[model samples]
Target chain A: MSCLETIQSYSLRSIGIGERLLPRSDFTLCEQVVLIGSGMIWNVYFGLMALTTGFFLATAIALGKGSANPWLRKPAEWFIFLFRGSPLFIQFFFAYFLFLNLKGAYPFFDPFTAAWLGALIVLFLNTGAYSAQIFYGALQSIPKGEVEAADAYGLSGWSRFRRIVWPTMLRLAWPAYTNEAIFLFHATTLVYFSGFPAWQQRGDALYYASYFADKTFNPFVPYPILAGYFILLTLVIIGLFGLVNRRLNRHLPANARSKMKLRLNLIR
Target chain B: MFSYCSDPDTLERLWWLSCYLTTGVHFSFYLSFLKVIGILAVTAPVALAFGFAGAMSARSQILPVSWLGKAYIAIVRGVPDIAFFLFFVIALDQGFEWLRHQALCPDWTDPIRQGNDFLVCPQAKLPLGTAPQAVHQAYAFALAVMTFALVFGAFVANVIFGAMRAVPKAQLETAEAYGMSPRQTFWRILVPQMWVYALPGLSNLWQVLIKATPLLFLLGIEDVVYWARELGGTKTARFTAYPHGDWRMWYFLALLVFYLFMTWGSEKVLSRIMARLTRGQATTGGEAQRKGAPA
Candidate 1:
């Protein structure tokens, strides 16, 4: 097939759209590139969904962890420890098994077995737990002066937190949170590779890359293409988070503003 | 196994479980936990060596060598590390075979890349085609170790490079004032001090390394995850002495607990080490120690 024909056939293949069958043999370079790039839709989808939704849970968790009451604190602490302490790969296996058992008991949970819903839940919780830890640290490190100053202005309770505490915690947490975001996106690659089966061969970028690698018996081509897509995604995340970092630190003078640094590569 | 395990069907509930847990496959499952530890024990130092070299080269005055080191560090930055794990295993295996093929079979003119097959001559095969299964396993294990070292070395290099830069410039200047050579300043003054700053990152990397051990299954190794799945799946009465329904959930739960224990233990030990390292240093940790001490 010509490159256009190949793109037309396999462009949306990752979501089980255009193509029902993946290329079997004599796979062309165009086919590999298009199919792998097509698979990135799932990666982007998982990352964005988990991140946006997980943000609220993370905030609540951070607050709970910082709470003085044992009732609030213990569960939050254990939640963080439970998810953060174990490997995510194992979490995926254990979760899939749990969901499968749940489905067995109640047919209502049938949708939980699919990668789109099931794997997404795991990613959501995992990121929530990790980002909670980051945010909890940020909450602790929020300068005492900021809170005392807010108190002097009669800003109290929810209003005080809304105006003063939350922004500072976010500002302090943004850099590490950026690293977490990138890691989350990278982790979307694990969904298919784990216990969650891709329905009808609809998997993520790594899934397609490995597929091509298996077919061609050539690792050099497809994996690099996967890596390239991921690099681009990483850059996009950094750029987007940089914008937020700037906004979060906008109130501070430029000279005193803390810049976001992509300090660690393998955080998770 | 027990004397009564010979007739699993007649065994009582607890006894059946005990026998099931002590079966030969379960023994191998137990052994795979050691394999994870073995990988960590070996990979840690090897990766440190690789990272030290990478950091030194990046910090090198020479342009090309510095770029090479920078590239090595940068390569792992943007991509998911699992990609590297998946890529490196096959890539390294083929690379070795291709090099050996060129060296060992000079007269062979047929293209190695014939459609989907990587057809290296038999002489080029790692551990040789005639080698025992044990040799092949060893070779695969070695490749896994190398792959882990290469990817993790880059992360370690980034840590060490930052730690090296973090060493206060005044200390190096004092070393120069003492008539120490540049090499002496690096070895005697810089390397010694870099560890305190590097410790936190290294400890974090250690946790990451621990979590990453489960990926061994992806490398086709019979690690804990592999055995957990194999042994946990439904075992039919016709096929085996002890048959059970799908018990994968329990197996994975056990694996999860093992990892949690491993990470929790590491955290405790790492904090102790961090405290010891910080006791005499000028960092905040040291200052706290100093103030808290009996004066």
Candidate 2:
């Protein structure tokens, strides 16, 4: 089949939409690229949803941890510790099993058996814990003078936080937070490989790539396509985050604005 | 393991659980934790060695050699390491067998790639096919260790290279002015001071290494994750003694706790080490240590 025809057949193969069966034999370059590209849809889905939701949760966690009330601070501290200390791979497994057990009691949790809900939830919390730590560190690093200035102007509590503290925390934290976002996407590759089954071969990019590798018994072709897709995705993440980084630093002089470089902070 | 455990059906709930936890498979399940630890112990030093060499190469004056070292560091950071974990094992295995094919089975003429199949002569198979199960397991584990080392080594190289640059230029120049050779200055001034800078990144990489260990299951090794899934699956009464319902959640919870403890313990130890290393140095940690020390 032609490249366009191959794209048509395998474009949504990951979600079990278009193709009934994957190519059995006679593997072609087009088939590998198209199927893996289809799998990128899941990666983007997981990464985008997890990062977006985790952003709010992470902010809450950072604030909660910094609060003087032990009720809020203790749980926030433990949540950050538990998630950050454990491996994301183990978190995925633990989450899958937890969700599966919960499914019996809560019928609403039936989708947890699928990769979409279960693994996404794990990634959500894992990234939340990571970024919470980053934001908390940034929160501590905020200049004392800024908070003092806000207090002098009679801005206290929520008003001061919303106006002064929050923006500065984000400005200082954006560089590290950008790294966290990039790694979150990279970690999405582990979802299909984790305990959560792909549910009808509808796995992530790594899933489809490994599938073709298994079929062809040649690791050369499929993996590079997956890597190339990921690199492209990483570049796009950098671009989008760079734009936000710019807006965050819009108030500052050009020399004072922190440049957004992709620093690969090691791991969770 | 109790003497009263001849018949599982007759045993009470607590006894049955005790016996179940001592089964041979359960023993292997417990051993897999050691395997995870073993992977960490073996891979860390090996990776550091690779990192040291990589950093040295990156600093080399030769053009092509430096390019290769730089590329190694860059490419590893750019891609998701899971891809390398999945890719390198098969690639290395095929590479080894192909090398053996060319060496020992010279008379054979079959193409290694026959359509969709990777066909090699019997003599070229890793572990020789007639070897014991232990040999196969060892070979697989060795492949995993190598893959881990290669990947983490790149990260370490980045840290070490930056650390080397972070050392004071004045210190090195003073050593040179004192009639020390370039090599002597590097060994005395650069290497000694670089550790303080490298420690933080290395600690971060250590945690990342711990987190990445579960991917061994994807590499087809029966690591802790594989055993957790296998042993925690629902077992019927007919299947074996002490059958239980789906208890995977509990198993994974234990795994989670195990990792949390590991990381917490490591952080404590690493901080202590950093304290000792930073003592009497010029940085903030060192200054604090100097102040905190009684005269």
Candidate 3:
């Protein structure tokens, strides 16, 4: 079949659109790229949604962790420790199985069985904990002078936080936050691999790549293609985050500005 | 395992609960925890060796050797590591088999990649088609270890590379001034001093490597996660002597507690090591320790 036909047929193969059965034979590069790219939609969706929501939740967690109140600090510390201490792989399994038992008890919560709800929830909480730790570290590192400056200007309570502390915390945390975002994108690939089943073969990039590998018995082709796509995606993420890092540090002198190099040392 | 455990249906109260908790599946659940540790014990040293080679290569004066090392570290870092894990196992297995195919069967050649199947001579089959099941499991475990090492090696190399750079240049210069060769200085001064700087990153890497052990399940290894799922899923009474309802939550909770304990224990050990390693060094930790000593 022609490349156009292959694209038309397998474009939405991941979400169960266009073609019912995946290309069983004569798998073309066009089919592999299109199907994998289509699958990447889910990766992007999971990463974007989780990172965006996790960002706000992480800020609250950071604040809670740094708060003097034991009620806030203790729970926040436990939450961070619980999620950060374990593997995301285990977290996915634990969450899925826990959700499964919950669904058994209450039939109304069936959505947790699917990746959309189940994996997303796990990713959200996991990233929240990780980013919270980063944010907490950053919040602690926020210069005392900034807060004192706010206080001297008659800024107190909400205004002081809004004007001084929050910005400084973000500026301090931006580099680490970028690393978290990159890993969150990578962690999305683990969703389908976990206990959560990919309904109708609607899965992520690695899932589709694995499908192709299983079919063709040729790991050389599909995996590199997937890797290439991910590398490109990562570059795009780095670029976007670099832009934001620049804005966050726009006021600083060039020598004082923190360079946002990709540090692969941190694990999710 | 009480004597009354033979008739679980008749038993009541805590006695029945106690027996149920110590079932055969629970034993497997407990064993799985050891498997996680086993992966760490094997993977850490291998990955460290690989990282050492990678760092040395990256620092090589030869352009291509350095470039190759840089590329290895960069590619792994750029992509999602899970992607590499999913890819490398199959790719490495196939590469091995393909080499074997060429070596074992010289006369027979009908295109290895014919259509969708990857057919090879029976003589070249990894673990052989008729090998014992244990051999197959061992082969799979080996691949999983390699995958973990290859992926984490890149990160470790990054850490080691930075640590090597962090070693003061003046120390190396002084060694060179004493007529010591570059290699001698690297071993005597650079390598020794680099550890103090590398300890922090290595400790963090150790924690990550510990946490990443669960990914073994995804690689098709019968690790802890696999056993937990297998043993904890809804089991009918017909299947075995001790059957229970869906108890995966409890199984996973056990896993969580196991991991928490492992991490906490690791932190304690790592801190002690760090303290020991920092002694007498020209670093902050060393200075603090010296000051705190009796005057």
Ranking by lDDT: 1, 2, 3
Best by lDDT: 1
lDDT, candidate 1, B202-242, per-residue tens:
99999999999998888988899999999989989899988
lDDT of 3 at B237: 79
Query: On residues A81-118, what C-alpha lDDT tens digit does candidate 3 reach at each position?
Result: 99988888888888998888889889987999899988
User: Over 4 Å off in model 1, which ranges?
Assistant: none
Candidate 1 vs candidate 2, lDDT winner: 1
Error of 1 at A218 (Å): 1.1
TM-score (chain A only) for the predictions, listed in order: 0.98, 0.97, 0.97
Better of 1 and 2 by DockQ: 1
Model 2 C-alpha lDDT versus the unseen true structure: 0.91
Ranking by TM-score: 1, 2, 3
Q: Which residue segments of model 3 deviate by more than 4 Å?
A: A265-267, B1-3
lDDT of 2 by residue, A48-106 (tens): 99999999999999999998999999999999999999999889888988999999889
By DockQ rank, best first, the candidates go 1, 2, 3
- Candidates 2 and 3 compared: the better one by DockQ is 2
